[model samples]
Target: MPTDADDRVYYVISDLHVGGDEQLGEVEALPELLAFLERLERTDENAELIINGDAFGLWEITSVEGTDKFDYLTDTYPRLFEQLRTTGDDVTITLLPGNHDHELAAYDEYVDRFAAYNVTLVQDDSFTRRVGDRVVYFEHGHQQDPNNRIEDWGNPDASPLGYYYNTLVTSRAGQLSDRGRYNWLKDVQAVTPTERMPVWLLSKYFYREMNPLLRYALVPFLLLFNVSAVLAVLAGLSLADIWSTPVEEGTAFLGQFGAAGTALWFLLAVNVAIAGLLLLVGIPLYFLRRDVRKTIDRFGVFETTLTVDAEEPYEKAARERFAADEETAIYCYGHTHRPALSEVDGGVLVNSGTWLKRLHRRDGAIGVLPPVFYPSYQLCAVRIAAEADSVAVEFEEIRKPSPSTEELTLTERLLTLGRKPDPELPDRAEIPNGRSATPPEPAE
Candidate 1:
């Protein structure tokens, strides 16, 4: 709600990560975005669309520099640019720079270039808009993130920890993605918490890139690994005269099937032997790993968890803002790519989520297989407007099917049969005038 206009509406989205090099340049939700923009163009309401942050994957565009990156994006996504131009004519459109697209703030040329397409680029880290009697604070939410926070906000040379990560890992993945068997390396950005990327790569390599013959040959051994370890333990106990031999009984049962049974028993014996050797070695390795971890802790090598707790800093900032301004009713942002809405003090803390593909990790039901990263789409627009005596916030999802069939191998699909992600969002929430009601339960 704008103080000057009671009917004004705000639509917010973030982390589009639209522009990149080669395979990374692919925008999976481009159709939905185009349709959304067209709808905005047709709307009669007084609307303002704000791209909270990381709208462009400027960090992934390593081939170009400065405003040339903007040129590349415009040329590459002419349709999207046209839609933005059309939508901007009817509704005010604002773009905020996030960690990936920090170059937008670093270069003055971006302001003019984006304006040519009717996108008003906001160079500051955060801004506030009045909603009825209260105010809503808007930011990309990267300032509170240590890895992405820019010490010199608008300085071109101000590369944070996240900058190098995008350069070396994300961009490189884009350049090399097509070389992979399934062309999936470009999705390196979708793995949340950043720490899961290595495991994700291993999973993809095993399921998609590994040789089928080798994989199948090893499947039986892997599937029976735990059973073999137990059998090996029982065999050791029998050898030590502490227990009867279950291994012998099991092999005798198998031997009743003749040559095939003998072969199966031989395989089992080999497996047991290997498992026993691994167990003996693993015992020492486990202790060694613990000692190494302790030493690393002593040296303070990893002071923080792989996935930083995104809630603490942002919530702390929200609390501070609430304490400072009694009129502030909403603190909305989008950098962590998690769509969430909950009451903070009397106000609501909201995350806009992302337009990019989201990967939900699903552990293997059994065995030591790497976890499958189930892909899904959470394309959404967060709408905020006036609602009588209270401020209303709503999350509207743009439905789109995930590319699991194309992205995941058959094994991955079989392993994660019934565990598809179905994330819940609070359909609509109200920030009361009194600022005392509990937040509504998230929609089922």
Candidate 2:
């Protein structure tokens, strides 16, 4: 059905990563997603639901063949697929391949298969649509990334660094965490800067694998060890007489001991202090030397910036790029997994963040062996419509009625310890890719 009217609506979202793995299938916000779809169906009948990329997560598949992923996805989430089918009846469903699901572009059958469900599969690298007399660019935005960008964009056999990362790190986490007390492995994909993955993996081991009593016992010692390290440094300075009063002023203090005895006393005191520190901190450091070193190496300057909570550089770049193109008034894409909407120059850029759980660390809270996965939902979708003179873009965080944490499994509740307070969004959206311009729907 072709619409000749200039006033059009585009409903965009990305990085659904449905059937991400057995564990991802469990924690996915399917209810919220279905609700979002249903709401869209009721709002705009001719709207196009654009799933920009990484929709299926075929790269996370360990054993399934390329072509069988659709069936696997359908089998894993029957209700979700059914909702998609129903929603497709009301709105046009468009699928664009991202790096994780690049196989979709390589296999034409995927297009036909989705078409059977009233969904349209786009094999191109990007798609453009006209809205309000201006061209709007829609792309997955993966090519800009060094790790995920493929040399041969649409080739299925071409492997990018991201493919290996997913296979080795992501898929491995999937397999191991699937067996955990909670199906928490799906959050592995939420990590950014990617360096944090190993640290997160270590936390997962401590929480899920280690003996509870033994682990709790180590917590106190671990904290004491930090204090011990600080004390050791102070002992070194004390021995050097950095804080000492002049010998003339300290006559009473030294008068109690002979000249040589004074020097010996200070040395003995410093040595004893150092010895105590060695017992408290040095012993644990000796035992966990390899781990401590690995932690230091990971955090010691190179790629040290934890980009997870940081605003994505790609979003800024995309906004600038869109601003340069005069004809295009809007640029919409979604690889960063953080929803955003902003005006750049005469144009605007929108990023549809992932449907998966997002972990947000607080402003200044550092954690001790924190949970690998922080429980959060940044589930959202972008609604784009033509206005009188411009294209109106809105980022809406999808909300759903969730059960109490008591209903959550034991492991799920355990994963919430040391988590940051719920992140606060500002009232104004302001510029490109910040918080939403309008207030997001209140949490249910």
Candidate 3:
């Protein structure tokens, strides 16, 4: 028997990444997350909660394997599971497997366990729903990504390259991140390129591990090092008495110059010494960076996405998928952890970014001195509802304010010092209805 629930408002969120061990604490916004579910109970009592994918971090499981994970997850996140059960009374809960938690699809026992809580486990590769006049297509979205696309899905032994990378790199980082005050570094798995890891890791060290005094001191030191070379050249010429070429026209040049020149030379000489010290340090540092890059390259990566300026692979695939069947006007997915809303194929495509705190280096501000990891949260849910003739997708950011939310990175502070203080407000954006057509594919 089939039932229709068109009036039901749909809510989708993904990438909670509840880790295998004690990593359940990684869900930073516990209060707000529970608040959101409670809101669902009060507002749309029978609304469906489709956790599009990556609900649990099976890849992060280090010790337990086989059906043991079922108990481990339930034990670790008893409160969360209990909340799900309570919420299931009003809202139908659904879980799908993303690349990180492909094991959910590997075993049928997982389905039975979830069934106890009245939660529906979507084992299919993709799911769809009708919204007003349009059909919305949903998937975990790793299929389009080669590294994460599992050819032999649903086999406990079968693992993708992404799974291995997470186990080796991400698990190691997450373990260390837990020691830091904020465990945002655990989510570093989302960042790509085998090379980016060292820089990103260094940024974490600067922010989380480094002594406050040393971290603050390094800023001015970096600035001074940049202009030190020019200062050194000036001092070298001044010391050679080039500025004191006994003026044949007048001794006035020497008399007034003598007083200022001595003072100036002293400062210049200091600059030369500092610059010399910097060069002593910088030369080795420059070589060290090169060595690190080479080492990471040698360690190798399974795949690196070569994303272009405007044409992201997921967006491209969405547009083509929509074009293939004119019925589907909306394509939504998770896994990118980037909240995106773009116009394509006469409809819209949206990404339900992850709940985990994301870290991106804001290199635009500083000219690349150990790129700063700006901690941010895309913590959001995509709401789909029937519109006049088509369906509309809205991104609702769920906030749990902490001191870290407003705190600026050292680099961000230095860059925006003179500018009018940023007018920080709640995360609310007036999204434009449409955008330029997806640019033509790069010429072959």
Candidate 4:
């Protein structure tokens, strides 16, 4: 199916977890990424580079500042922009926000700071691009996480603590636990079954308990933890079965207590037990709940869809002015970290694979399973090529240098101390809507 025309249009990388611990030996991958950019600039003058999401770990920095961890990335970001600008001066650069760097919600700061580099920051998770004759939608795909249903962010009934826990602590913690390179003990500490279980159970109860009343309220907040727990559990099971060597029977039970003993041991154990129960109960509830059925109707089992009011006067005005169609265009998103491309009856659906690496290690006779580091790791990009007859699209990964054994050793040592550095923010004034003032240039 390869063609010369398809080769003419290329989509560059996005969601590079530059500062995260997953960068392991892949440090060399940075220059390779840059080189890839250089090659694109030289060979494909009309090519567009779209950084889909998680371009930076702003949220991670807020939680655990790892300057050195992100040092390579911070140093490279501005330069990356400058290089792109120099390459074509007219090349299109579109940046979307992922849960990791959702600063785009506050767009004014991003634009004012990065405007000189010609970067366009999108406001909402959803946007449309035109390639030839086709229209393509772009979103970070976090809304489908169930734990971060996106609708709950602005709901009136949601508590600030609930919102913060779901958006910041739980989601990020789950991600770290799922993708971090450390042993299973560290992963367990970062995200416990207890934390994930209650959130799942409560979310199910709240959604069913209140129905439409709490649809926007409790459901989103509760689902945040539920979804996270599911992912964490999946990751934990995979890690325990795969990379981890079997412990002596006595050590296995003791290890379940985790790092700390004392009263915390019993408390954690109880929480873990509760979480286990919730998962046991929640899995079935997920199948039985009417509200979940409704969710399934609106958004596919592993999908998310947002129906904006196109007929609204304000929306109409914007659509007309922006040359957008007035018809309600459905944008479907998913968080399975596996990129999907499909056409639905009325709109389009996309899956933005994770920015983390899916790393798996096999310890001789331990077992074989999905690597903790390997589940959703890949820097991917999608190009929507719309010609008059039909629309075609393709995805690609931007390969980078991986971490070496020595680097892993150093990372493990640093992580043991819980002293990762923070990412640097530009001194420019914050953007008003956390998006770029300029709309993204049309896809080529």
- Top model number, TM-score: 1
lDDT values for all models: 0.87, 0.67, 0.68, 0.43
Clashes of 3: 0
Q: Which parts of model 1 are misplaced by more than 4 Å? A: 1-3, 240-245, 287-301, 304-307, 442-444
RMSD of each: 2.4, 7.9, 6.8, 17.5
Q: Which ten residues in a row have the lowest lDDT in candidate 3?
A: 422-431
Query: How many backbone collisions does model 1 have?
Result: 0
Question: Which pairs clash inside model 3?
Answer: none
Rank candidates, TM-score, best first: 1, 3, 2, 4
Candidate 2 vs 4: which has more lDDT = 2
Model 2 lDDT per residue over 1-444, tens place? 435536667778898887655565564577777788778667644677888998878888876887898898778877777777888877778889998889999888898888877789999888888766667788887776756777786687978777887877777777777577555555788775477677666666666666878877876555454455555555555668784343334445665778876885565455547657666785777879988778977886434232322345555765676656656667777887766655555466667788776655322122234543444667777777665544567766677433325223354355455553364221222222321234334322
- Candidate 2 collision pairs: none
**Better by lDDT, candidate 2 or 1:** 1
Residue 8, candidate 1: how far off, in angstroms?
A: 1.9
TM-score of each: 0.93, 0.75, 0.76, 0.46
Q: Can you rank all candidates by lDDT, best first?
A: 1, 3, 2, 4
What is candidate 1's lDDT per residue for 1-444, written digit by digit as tens?
223455678899999999887899999899999999999999878889999999999988999888888889989999999999988887889999998999899998889888888899999988888777778899999888877889999999888888888988899999999997888898888889998888998888888889998888876668899888988899899889888667568867897999999898888788889999999999999999999999999998786654556688788889899889888878999999889887788788899999988999999887778899999998899999887888899898899988889888888888888887787766678877876535878654
Which should have the higher TM-score, number 1 or number 3? 1
Q: After superposition, how far is residue 434 of candidate 2 from its true place, in Å?
A: 22
Candidate 4 weakest lDDT stretch, 10 residues = 423-432
Which pairs clash in model 1?
Answer: none
| Candidate 4 residue spans exceeding 4 A from truth | 1-13, 20-29, 63-78, 150-335, 346-348, 360-377, 397-444
